[model samples]
Target: MSGSTFALRVAQGVGFTGAAWLSGNIAALSANSVPAIISSVREDNISPNVACKQWRNMYEAGKTQNPPIAFATASSFAYVAWSVRQIPRSLAASAAYGGFGMYVAAAVLTLSIVPYTVAAMRPTNNALLELAESKGDRVTSSAEVEGLLGRWTTLNWARSLLPLAGGFAGIAAALL
Candidate 1:
């Protein structure tokens, strides 16, 4: 096989794996980790301050980890699309063009979570971070912390869908 063929295969593999990994990581946080933190506060097992601080720690960790995954996944998808584009149309069938489209879409969708977070989720994140920094003193009651946490969870759930969609697109491309 040619170098371009090898690169295309590598890009496809990286894009699919990275997209799935990022999506699963986000979903795990949304489904299990965040809820457990909120549950601790709700059950009074931990003070709201402690819960917020714990949440902040998790959020910070994700901030460090997730962006790189997203970017790498998107870059891989973009590279796959570029590689697909390099194939001569006479040799590349209609399915190859379709895969190229899907790869491009995958790249866009995978990267979209970053802007989505900035636009849709930043306010809640900022508020939560503030509360965490204040040791929960900024809020009137534990309920407020719970509300923010719930909102964050909901937003995160939505955010998780972007990479999931990208992964699905990647799968669709591979099938094509």
Candidate 2:
């Protein structure tokens, strides 16, 4: 009935979709890319160069979906930003305000990771991207690629937690 109620619903929807996209990205990395990299490194059946190429190929393919996913994630934040202002300052008796608070927390929590990711992970990501796009010899050796990917995957896990939490929080907010 209220604007906050509507906003919470929007946040819930957007957050869930965004979270699902993010999870898929993680799942692909976990299920496919990471294992492939490990297999490439340890086993003689797959050469390091071949594996690196596969990894780079897959990495580039995966990146194509990022823009839409990023937009979806930002949409959730937008809903929260719009809705929170509708909530009153006096939170003593308002359930709607409480719910909005959770929604805001969801956005804030998720957004908090962005800066760290941009600042910390950007260079490594750029390097990998360049490798992915490169047609000739890789800039780094296979061992280094493996290390970089391992670090990226580890950081990705950390990055994933926030939107997941935000999605759940948004759901709770909507229900409340």
Model 2: per-residue lDDT, tens digit, 118-175?
A: 8876877776666666666644576777777777777767766766776677667666
TM-score of each: 0.93, 0.69
For model 2, name the residue pairs that clash. Answer: none
Cα lDDT of model 1 by residue, 43-126, tens digit: 866877788889999999998999989999999999998887777776558888998999999999998989999999999999
Which number leads on TM-score? Answer: 1
Q: Give the number of the best model, judged by lDDT.
A: 1
Model 2 backbone overlap count: 0
The alpha-carbon deviation from the true structure for residue 63 of candidate 2, after best TM-score superposition, in angstroms, is: 3.0
Error of 2 at 153 (Å): 1.6
Off by over 4 Å in 2: 1-11, 84-94, 111-116, 130-141
